[model samples]
Target: MAETAVAAVLAELAALEDPKVRAVNEKQGNDHGVNLTKLRALAKQLKTQPELARELWATGESAARLLSTLICRPKAFERDELDAMLRQARTPKVHDWLLTNVVKKNPHAEELRLAWLADADPVVASAGWALTADRVAKKPEGLDLPGLLDVIEAEMKHAPDRLQWEMNSCLAQMGITHPEHRARALAIGERLEVLKDYPTPPNCTSPYAPVWINEMVRRQAAE
Candidate 1:
């Protein structure tokens, strides 16, 4: 019964074109919206039927995105599942989740996530930096610390002023906290010197930035 439903849902989702899925994905609410509801239902279905997740993942990027969200949420994904999900994920959404969670879970994800540095899309490239910050916190060896710095620095060169400011904030967290690597992060800041006179960083008004900065600083210092 569950398998039938999973197949139908996947089939329906598979019929969606990339442009259509990208359009809907762009509108994804920060709070998950209806997608969260479907994610929960599928999670339950997958519990008794783990194969459903594989089926959903095999469908396409849309299903992969949906699965990545569910796989990151509580009471659903465990360490091993996260491992597997990152191991197989190939979509941008999956890349985002992998960037967001994998480093904290395992050091091996760095190599995979760093490859996104060359991705043509800035969003994916930014996500790669975000993942670099994640792995840097763990102080994992053999990871591309300098390469990550290069990407962030390069991003400030032609990136929009708004994104440049965001990189500044990431710099503060990555540089100020990781003393050993603080110089690398500061190099990124130097590359974004255009931001120094902006009064406040472009997007610092958001409530989340200060809190995130504070926490990241604290964690980096602790590391």
Candidate 2:
């Protein structure tokens, strides 16, 4: 029955695949060309089917892996399995989805986060930074905010692209949530000058750290 379900889901995904989108997806390092909107709709159809999700994930197709993240039960995965999955993530989008939808919801998240942050693998490190940013945005009660600021100040410019984006996000979160850190965050942003010259779409918040911090602070004050 699970095999049949997996086959049906795979068929549906294949039916929704677009060659043009697939070409673009390949460029972005995704292995499949299924439209994300269609994938989400398909995931809804296969909701909460961990057995089916497991089978789909084993197939190693990008869209299948994405659907697996959506349908798999967080508690059903062991630590080693999650680690293996993280190690297999090859693209930024997949890494983001796996961390946000799968790893962060799992009970082993904190332990994984701590270990992955120091991991030599760039993908794992990206997941760790993403998870940390999520935590900093939400609970943040026990986190060492000052230490985080220090790390960002010291290493952000030198960090890999994916890790740097999340680290910068963590810095922005600190400035947004802890008013006391705003000045220091701004100062750190100034010193690092990370994303300083990146062009932002009109009316979009600039990802440049100082501009990001100021915009977030202004929005918070109005709220």
Candidate 3:
């Protein structure tokens, strides 16, 4: 029964694939070509079906996994299950969507945050830093903000692209959300100059930390 349902969902996802969409996704490191808006619409239709979600995720196809994150009960997953899923999420979109929709909301979030942060795989470690950035922005009661800066200052420049981007996000979030570390964050962003020349579309904030920090700060002051 489960295999038949999983195959049906996979067929639906396969039917939605478009060569043009895949081309764009390929440039962004996403392997699947399904439109995200449509994917979300499908997820909405599926609602919260944990059994179906597990079936979809087990398919190991990127689009199926992305949909799995949507319908799965985040809290239903075991810590080890989440860890295995993270390891299986090698593609960018699936990995990111899983973190955004499932892992971040799981009760084991903080525990996994600490564990994944120290993972030897830079990809896994990037998820840890992404969670830390969320904490820095929202629930940073016990985090060592200064120590995080210390790590970013020492490691960000040489880290792999995936890990470095998350580290940069943590730095930006710290500067934007915590005034105490704002100056230090800006200084580090200046010195490292990571993403300094990243091509940002007009009116979009640059990922270059100094510019991103200042833009967000300016918006906050305005509000």
Candidate 4:
């Protein structure tokens, strides 16, 4: 009965694919053609089903994995299960969705954050940085702000694309949240110049750390 349901869900996801969108998604290292809004709608219709989510994720289909993250019960996942899922989440979209939707809400988030930060794989480490950046922005009382700045200054420039983006975010968040560290964060950003030349659309903010930091800080001061 469960196998039949999983097969039905996979077929539904397959039917949603668009060649043009899949081409675009492929460029970003994702293999799916499903629009996120449509995927969310599907998830809402399916509702939360942990076992079904696990089965969908095991199918190794990017679209199904994305839908799984949307419908899974975050807290139901064991720490080891989340760890295994992170390792298997190879594509950028799946990796990001799993981190944002599932891992962030897991009970063992901090422990996993530290463990994954020290992970040898940059993609996995990026997830760690993502988790750390969340804390830097929200619950930063005990975190080592200066030390984080130190690492970003030293390693971010040499990091891979995925890791570099996450580290840059952490640096920007650090600057945005802590007035004391803002100038140093700005200086490091200026020195590194990572993503400085990134082609950002006119209305959208650039991902370049210096510009992102300044823009956010400016907004905070105004409000």
Per-residue CA lDDT of model 1 for 21-131, tens digit only, reads: 455666542212225345556545555443555555565554545653444332345545554554455444555555454344554445545554455655545555565
> Is 3 or 4 the stronger prediction by lDDT?
3
User: Tens-digit lDDT track for model 4 on 44-102?
Assistant: 99999989999999999889999999889999998999999999998989998999999
Tell me the tens digit of each residue's lDDT in model 2 across 1-223.
4677778888888898899998988876676788888888878876788888888889888888889899999887889999999988787677778888988889999989988989997667878887888888898888898998888888899998778888988888888778898899988989889999987889999998889888887887798
Taking all chains together, each candidate's TM-score versus the true structure is 0.51, 0.92, 0.98, 0.97
Question: Which candidate gets the maximum lDDT versus the true structure?
Answer: 3
RMSD per model, one decimal: 7.7, 1.7, 0.9, 1.0
- Please report, in order, the local distance difference test score of every candidate based on alpha carbons: 0.52, 0.85, 0.94, 0.93
Best of the two (2, 3) by lDDT: 3
Those runs of model 1 whose alpha carbons end farther than 4 Å from true positions after fitting are: 1-3, 7-38, 41-45, 48-50, 61-64, 68-95, 101-108, 120-124, 143-151, 160-172, 180-223
User: 2 or 4: which has the higher TM-score?
Assistant: 4
> Model 1 compared with the native: what TM-score?
0.51
Candidate 1 structure lDDT: 0.52
